[model samples]
Target: MPDPSQKRPVIALTGATGYIGRNVMESLIDDYDIIALSRNGDAKDNEEHVEWRSCDFFSFQDALKGLRGADYAVYLIHSMLPSAKLTQGTFEDMDVILAQHFARAAAENGIKQIVYLSGIIPPHEHRDELSRHLQSRLEVETILGSHGVPVTTLRAGLIVGPDGSSFPILAKLVRRLPAMILPSWTRTKTHTIALPDVIHAFQQVVGREDVYSRAIDIGGPDVMSYQELLQRTADIMGKKRRFIPFPFPTVKLSRLWVTLVTQEPKEMSYPLIESLAHPMVAEARQTVPGISDGKITYEEAAAAALDEEQKKQEEKKREQEEEGSKTPSPVRKLKQAVKSDVRSVQRITLPEGQDAIWAGDEYLHWLSRLASPLLHIKTTRTGVQQVYVLWWKKPLLELTFDVGMSQSDHAIYRITGGRLLHAKRAHNGRLTFLQIPNSRECIVAIHDYMPSLPWVMYKYTQAKIHLWVMKAFGKYLRRWKHRSTTDTKAAPRQAMSQHDSTVR
Candidate 1:
């Protein structure tokens, strides 16, 4: 028995409402108090030993506030699903921003360690050619430790869980499809782990100083191709699913087929299907003690997942019957229907030795010149930037500098209000110019921007124009590399110091 009077350490968990997060939070409750962080924290039920706190990872302030008073943290955040109605960047870029904020916040709050769940990376040679999904995972893993916080990274490939997007999609495909064409990518070998094993791994690692800053590759007892995984799932479910060998690794067709047959959104299926082409088997050297000794096989995992899924469905049905005629709020219904937020992320080459501050200033100056009389940028006395159309007094967009969030390497401008934006939204839309460290590259991104125009109209007009502008800017930057390094002088301003007054 434990000491009755001892205070329990709090473990702050990002993605606390997610599938793995829910399991981990429940399993570890006996050992520690859980600070469950979610976007809709106020709405989440708080049980004993669990406290819900709203956290928007994109916001550094929220990240810091959420992690306060927590001894350790579990980072299970991924930007696969949009957090805003109008997310304006790629998942990879979005993941970068979130990781940076969380890592920095953890450091500021004096968090002892951060346990991150990531995908198993392939060998060195194939890393360069990794799928976007794996690449994003690697980027996140790197960023989490950048703040000097001891990070315990558990790298997993396919997690066999009942509720998550991956396993459920596979289970649905096997149950629904009588016959399937197994593409060449499906032959690639990968490791799988049961959901419980993953939860146990988190239990073992959180606050374990010994495993701090160590990365352990974890998987189940089975090492098999995706084809084998599908077939084994079918066998466990007692279904007769057929497979025809597809000669070509047609990932596009496979993605579509998986989405169509499984009835999962393409957002979930596309990246996963693309990743099947790679071998995701774990290496022997990265394994540690308790986590490596996991005994669940693929078949066992499949059975458990299917059983849990059945139970979940029954529970959901029961709940529906208990609450008859309950309806979602009108605001929620409106949000669901008008979720056509625009997200555009582009990577442009940074001139050697130039930082994000310099790049941002140059962008404004360059845009003013490039668009000329048709589109011009004007700066307010308060340093806010406004874009104007030909002879129009009202600005097309308003960008206010977020001094608190901006640094030498990263510059952030909040889209406070403009004629081109929706009146209300979940988050403050922001434009960021980030210079990646130790590399001649920068990411110019827009996030959570809800366009005022209809989705169809904005997609065709402003969206296309934005892409074209970024592309042209990229080409122009590349041309600077060949010029006499004097282009830096053209920058009209520098990034405000961190101590500068912040503008709301």
Candidate 2:
């Protein structure tokens, strides 16, 4: 059954599910056999081309599991936008640990080449003043190279594409804001690259010994200011925006503003905001003829990216329509599949009515606080989806989401960063109170979502903990009802005593 002729060189691609990684695999799958790594460990029968590997890079052993039998291990993984719960230290620390493990694994597994994508840093004169994100990227690059692995680093700035961290935020910021309340960071200049260009750069360097253990800066032909990037993006989207550069430094304030306007979490926007303050450009780009010839202008890339995004939206709409047509009913509903595979749903019927159990906003806030002391639950409104940001005090990881509801029914529960890709560790849950038309009693449904990992972790550790929480939640509802009943009884007794005292 084995075909030796068709067997290609295996490329273990970590962060394969990421925006850049997905594009890279799509482009390179024909040339190389690919091992796609996902943090969630998700695999389905219908997934095509690449071989899917489920192990996340959180553990050295677990991360190393996917790299076996591969000729080249692409380090697309990074911790830019960290997920729900980060126990201690910054993302910088975690990234260094991941690189050390990856380097060790590659050395042991006989993987010859290790290609990494990193953030663009300032030129040597200003390198020390690079932002936290850029600094973290440099640290990761340093760690990845220390094991004597032939690591080729492709340092890119302001990747402009669909589903990428940079351009989407810009497109959104322009569309959302009539006037961008810009700051000093807006004037910082940086080189930009198209998605296709970056992938081409990745493909060009395979098995090339000359470029080994060296850093190559990659970007589009055009270099522009951060403010110009914003304006041009706005122009591409057919919108005009007014800009006001504030007097103060924008590193911190810009983060807060982006989040407030776009509903993007600080985990993403903060690093980006910090990086925007620096003038990030390539120190050395390809001077050779063929490599430099293919570069696109920043405006062209933005326009093309916008067009691609629109087409994708149209395609998604068509698919949703087709799916809806196949399953037709009087009360029809469309829903998005939960992003995670680890799911738990529990239902309970309460004796009290939906109104009695369904408390107001104040009560909801109180319940959320009491349910988890670690959880700091807050909400933001996006034009499209309802956003909820949950920060677990125990772990610094914050789960920020844009929760969407189905058209007909709410079977709901749901909800990436760029390359230097990310791992999402989400534990999203909600309680819904329901009242049937005829029935007096109310129904409560508990739905939670998380990533599916090892059998022991999913079945024993995570599932059990979730079940216990659900049980405690039901108990809280029962206690609330009892307290309400007791208060009602005491009110009449107190009223009678007051009347008697007044009569006397």
Candidate 3:
């Protein structure tokens, strides 16, 4: 219990921009003076009690400035990006460097304790690639402990909430996928905690002194599989979803499929899928009283997510209707005309002796080539040396091709250029195309109706696809040079043929 008479602690928190860190910040705002550290330090300034500071944990000396006069600091930062360009070192090594720096900073500033959120890796469990993520987290915990700051480490899994990636993606997938062909790992058991429970756990860590310098695994009352969680989510959403489990499951492939449908980043989904392969249920049967006094069931968590999603949808619909009413009919029509075209082809002519046209064209091709990989697309030049653009609406699903399976049922393709445009989706095992005039460029957008999917994947895919399409247009211009050369050579032959025909 928090004592009213006690002096409110000045707490410095890292990862204030992240999902979990956001929630932790919100919960602790009224209770403590917070110096929130972020890479950009661009969080909203509405919270009167919170002071934002920019700090790169990679540089400890600068980050330590924020920790000065802090009573407790929360380390919620994790480099989950598989492609994060950290200094050439092991994940643990990088974590150790950051942790040591943070610890030294906190110690110099007279910080009393460090609170960390980490995933539980049960004793005797084999350390694998997935375990490395958890190991790095634990390494940071140890580093903080070595600084003589009392460390409270809470190990949790699958935190269910409105803004969290785990539940949102799961809920979206369950709602969007009417019939799910699941991997064998779908049956593996894991524990999950609700967002409120997670917040409460953090609150307990901050208020209690006895629990300092210790680690505890926190979970809900029930342990279940991904399949079970999906079914429960469907039930909460009032939808019936069929889930069929395959005997042999490849989690990597599964992760790719989810990435396509949900638009979650590959780095974020990879650890999740890999961890699901192993049972993450708690080893001890008894619950820790200090952590969770009452367990929130999976069903309840699903219901909360569903409720939040519905509320958001209603709010969005209202906003759209209000905007629609405010626009004049002519303006709306003009906007539609500019935005709708589907298929566009432009031809360019270059001077016989100059290469500027070809150079400009090649620049476009390079741009598209660079962007295509980010969308997980393979680019190939045709025999004509012309660029041919072909991509699925959801490119992440292409990973299923590795397993000889295709998401033909879920595939969508949209092509729009100039004044012609078409959007097609697979329905009844056939492509159903929707024609819209004035749509331009191929913007491969995932239309997941469910709110559970991660937004990062969608934004990243959209950005990559737009960049690649622009590149394709650039390549098309360069191809014109070859056509011009051929046309010049054929000009004399055509004239001679016309003269010979006339004489005959």
Off by over 4 Å in 2: 1-7, 46-49, 84-88, 125-128, 285-294, 317-504
Give candidate 2's TM-score: 0.62
Per residue, candidate 1 scores C-alpha lDDT tens digits across 127-221 of 67999999988878888898789999999888987888778888888888899888898898989988888988988888778889888999888
* lDDT scores of the candidates, listed in order: 0.81, 0.62, 0.59
Most accurate candidate by lDDT: 1
- Per-model TM values vs. the true structure: 0.89, 0.62, 0.60
Sort the candidates on lDDT, descending order. 1, 2, 3
The regions of model 1 sitting more than 4 angstroms off are 1-6, 86-88, 319-342, 422-427, 481-504
Residue-by-residue lDDT tens digits, candidate 3, 1-504: 445588777889898878789888999987898888886676457367788887866444466676777888999876554212111223444455457668767887888778988876656665554455676676678777875778888887777887756788887698679999988988977788888888889887884788788887888877788888888778778898888879887877888888888877655666666667766665564246867543688778767867887897798778879887543343244344331111211222232333322233233344446556543333222101122234444322211111111111111221221111122422111111111111211111111111112335533553355446644654554454443444422322333455457768
Could you give the candidate ranking by TM-score, starting with the highest? 1, 2, 3
Q: In every candidate, how many clashes are there?
A: 3, 2, 15
Worst 10 residues of 1 by lDDT: 489-498
Predicted structure 3, TM vs. truth: 0.60
Model 1 Cα RMSD, 1 decimal: 3.7
